[model samples]
Target chain A: MNGHVYIIGLGPGDQNLLTLEVLSLLPTLTDIVGYGPYVERVEVPNTVRKHGTDNRQELDRAHHALTLAQQGHRVGVVSSGDAGVFAMASAVFEAIDQGDISLKTIQVTVLPGISAMFAAAARLGAPLGHDFCAISLSDNLKPWELILHRLKLAAQADFVIALYNAVSKARPWQLDTAFDLLRKELPTDIPVAFCRAISRKDEHIELTTLKNAKSSMGDMQTLVIIGSRYSRVIQPLSDCNPWFYTPRSITKK
Target chain B: MNGHVYIIGLGPGDQNLLTLEVLSLLPTLTDIVGYGPYVERVEVPNTVRKHGTDNRQELDRAHHALTLAQQGHRVGVVSSGDAGVFAMASAVFEAIDQGDISLKTIQVTVLPGISAMFAAAARLGAPLGHDFCAISLSDNLKPWELILHRLKLAAQADFVIALYNAVSKARPWQLDTAFDLLRKELPTDIPVAFCRAISRKDEHIELTTLKNAKSSMGDMQTLVIIGSRYSRVIQPLSDCNPWFYTPRSITKK
Candidate 1:
């Protein structure tokens, strides 16, 4: 019984965004497990045993996947976006590290996938061409102080930022605070784009400013993209949605 | 005679990373064009006419694709990683601007795909989980001063920085200058991860400090991932490669 684990990235909610690497490995997986809503994105064949739970139940799912893998099951833990980008890859490793699970015996390979930042960037244009970073506003795992420190750092850097887990159920005010801190460092006119439920049936993308993002953004599904000083939003034509771009060259003379 | 343009994203180098969204649209394309090296990553069928050229020839290719599309041909413009992130999508828009191409008549759809940053993040773990930015050190398009300003901003913000086009044939020391500026704002001890030819053969990933990165990097194929103030490089027991992670929670004790 050869037990191996493959941590797969399902991409941002669309089956079409799944990489061929992940798709090719689906058939070989004896068990597919992840956050329930994310696992539902993949159309797993009936042959593979599916194990899914809520987001808070990640540790439980990882333990189960590890147990199954140790018992000779070819397990694949799926995550939305890139599995390693605020996803399940780290949890799996942490779980593996917490115990004496001999990773030497079991093969573990992490397959990369499309992330929400890339999905959102495609819809909005190239606001992220220059320096940028992706930060999660959810305070579930980390302290808000640390998050605030990171936000302040991002603002001072004038780096375009892709914000993940921006506004969630329990953490509604997180984005507002982040926006406030960002506005202090960035210009009030800085361009901000919001992409909600990207690559999904009800996907919505809109452009605004950091000052106005609070009223414009609604829930956790939204990914906020804030541009640096160099990034600007341009409306191609009348009645056209504004697109973001970072000028290739800036002239000082 | 419908002239349509499908802007596709080819995942980081390896064909396996190409998304189903890009894959499903491949069969419908009659003309495929993109940056020379990236277009070679995809397998275009014999029926589809392929056009590939250097980065300098990007505007020409976009014009060619648009002209073909206007002539009632379905054209697909491909780019490595996501189409929007320093890829062909901007060139298409630039060509449209220069030539006054009527986008209203042409059914142009910009589809999302994975980016090199996401690929690098996935391979290296969660160094990018918080606020970050991507900067290109290529002086061909942007002036070195603007790049320095942006680097200064990123450093002040303490955002994780993903550097693209860091080193090339002409601009050898641009990365060194950028790194030096970054050191001014950030502590010299900040961890930096260099990922070369990710998701491809001869892939190399190493963790070092900003001060030591200049000698370690290679040509255009490499991606530099600089950790945030809180990020650290940990030597995981299972793998020889250094792993980076930002703690899920940060406590102010």
Candidate 2:
């Protein structure tokens, strides 16, 4: 009996954004494992077992998925957005790296999906059209100072920056401090976008400048995009909302 | 006669990577406009008009799509990978910004897809699992100095870097010079991956350290990934292929 596990990216919340490959793979999964919210996103038959764990338990979740696969069960360890982008793919690899000898026979395949940054960028009219970087602002696995260092350098590099896990109830002040640090490296008028509940029914986007940005505006579900110097807010030719983007071509004087 | 235009992402080259929304929206389109190669990817009936143009004609292509939309045609302007990332979304916005009064009435929608970077990363075991940046090595639009400056900062910041359009026949030496520049900030042992023809029939992935990376190994179809200090090539416990990834959790010294 061959038991192979797939670490999959479930994309954001929209069903329409789900890829045809994942949609096909979901029906055949013997066990679906992931964070509670991410596990709930996969709708399979009741006979197919589902293991939903709390957030921050990625390593343990990965170990469980590999164990199930070793037992000849077709398992899927899922993550929100692309699994490779600050998600379960790395956790699975870390588990393998940590010397799980039983996992030797198990094969893991990762599937990419529409990340929150790109999803938000599309709806916002391409704030990340040029060179860009994505940094998770949560200091859970890494130090806060490292996060601060990367944020400052990314701003100075003039790359459009995407902030993931920017703030939660417990870490309310991180995003605030991030903006303050960004101010020293970038102009106060640089565009900032807070994208929340992306692709879900309650999707909302709020655009502001660094000086006007309020840290309280975002919750756990938000993705914050800080545009580069070349980014602009294009006036709508008609009654449509404002279109914003960083042009691809720039001729520096 | 309601005219609307959707600037859509075609994913890389796999039909399975196509989202449910774009797949469903395909048959309903009255026209499809894109670069010659991207236009060939969308297979609609002959009733729907298809316009395929040459490369480097982004502004001209955007104008044509908007003009068709203004003429009351349901138009879809297709882009390879996500439209919002180094693709057509920004070009469309640039067209609007550059002033085409008739385009004001035409509404444009940008849809997200699986970017080439994510697709290649998924196949290569999550090289972008941590903080990462994407840079286009092409100096067509931006100055070489700006690219070099950003590259230096990104390396110094310890970002896992993804290089898009890393090399081509017309500009072959850029990537070679880029590696020399990267060597200044990154260690010689840092891992670099060359992913070519991602999700296509000719898919190929070559792994090398910065010291061994050759510029001639890639072409226009390749996306080169430069791993950070923490990234590693995981050993296979069994007969399976080697896995590589940057661990999600890092304890900065």
Candidate 3:
């Protein structure tokens, strides 16, 4: 019996962003597995069995998919953004590592998708045009001190920073603390973007400065971008959105 | 007369990776402007004019696209990966910044696509499953010293580093110099992935240790991923590809 697992990224809440490979393969899958929200995002055929779980249950979901694949069923594991970036790819691999040796025979492939950082950057102009880094602000997996350290180093390196999972109901003060930490090394006037629900209906984009940025501006769905020293905003002509871009070359003094 | 410029990413090599928005909007464009290779990659309708330019002439190409838009032509400016990441989006905006005031009235939007870094990462399991940064290795725009400095800092911060424009004919030594610099801060055993022509026919993936990595392993089309300290490789049962992933959490001993 042939069995395989395809870990796919749906791409930042927009159905149109789904890759042709993913769109073509979705109809062939026997089972679709993911977090409730991400699983619902894919419009699979009625014949496919859907297994949805909470966001925190990635391991369990990954194991379930693996079990199905091992049982000779082609399983589709979905993630909202690119699967390799803080998503199900790692969870699936980790599960496979801990599982029985027989599970290693199941073929697994991770299909890339448009991540939130790129989606947010496109909407807000090319603030990430130059060197950039992405660090998740959530401390659920790593300690807060490590996160703060990475933030400071990133600022010192002058990377256009993309912070994922910036604020959640359980961790309200972390983003504020991160801003405070960044303020020490970065200029207060640098542009900070709080992009919520990017590429989705009712999307909101808040263009603020480091000094004026607040934790209330973001939720778990928000992807926050802090511009590098070279990042700038071009004023709007009238009511049009302001264009933000970092020049490709930086003149060295 | 309505005039607009659409800066779009074709995604990493694969036609299937093109977003539905890009596919649907291609037929509506009056002209397509981009590097010769990228321009040829798009399957435009015969009615749409194709203006292909040399790669190093980004500014001139951007100006040309803007000129066509000003002439009431709907223009599509194309890039290979995500437009915002080391691509044409910045050049178009930079051109607009320096051009006539009337140019600001022309509508502009950037459509995101799957970047090579993400595509390569997905193909190589999940090497970028943590905090990461992408730095271009070419010194054509920035100084070699700055590139070396950023590589050192990125290593110090323990980032999963994605090196773009890794090796080119004019600047082959830059990549070798970068690896030597990284050797000072990063351990010798960290896994490095040289992924070439991601998502396309004749794609090649080479997994090696940092100590064993060579400049010859990469070229301009290659996306090199250097895993963080936490990254590990999962051995396959027999003939299947080995899985590489970094755990989401870091245990603070």
Candidate 3 chain B: 10-residue stretch with minimal lDDT = B236-245
Q: What are the TM-scores, per candidate, against the unseen true structure? A: 0.88, 0.98, 0.98
**What lDDT tens digits, residue by residue, belong to model 3 across residues B1-253?**
5478999999999899888888999999999999999999999779999999998999999999989988999999999999999999999988888888877878888999999999999888898889999998878888777888788889888999999999898988877788887788888898999999998898999999889898899777899999898888998774777777888888886
Candidate 1, residues B1-253: lDDT per residue as tens digits? 5478888887778878888878889888898888777767667678988888887777788888988988999999998887877777777766655566364355567877778887888787667655567787776776677678767767665667888887777778777877777777887888888888888898888788876867346677888888777776655555346567554445556
RMSD of candidate 2 to true structure, Å: 1.2
Q: Provide DockQ values for all models, in the order shown.
A: 0.48, 0.83, 0.81
lDDT of 3 at A236: 50
Candidate 2: lDDT of B47?
Answer: 90
Model 3, C-alpha of A245: deviation from truth (Å): 1.3
Against the correct fold, how does model 1 do in TM-score? Answer: 0.88
lDDT of 1 by residue, A118-178 (tens): 7878777666655567777777777788678777877665667788888777767778888
> Least accurate stretch of 10 residues (summed lDDT) in model 1 chain A?
A98-107
- TM-score, structure 2 vs. true: 0.98
How would you encode candidate 3's per-residue C-alpha lDDT over A1-253 as one tens digit per residue?
A: 5489999989998888888888998999999999998888889889999998998898899999999998899999999889999899999998988888877888998999989999999998899999999998888899888898899889988999999889999999999999999888998999999999999997899999998999999888899999988888887564578888888898786
Deviating ranges (above 4 Å) for candidate 3 = none
Best-to-worst order by lDDT is: 2, 3, 1
Candidates in descending TM-score order: 3, 2, 1
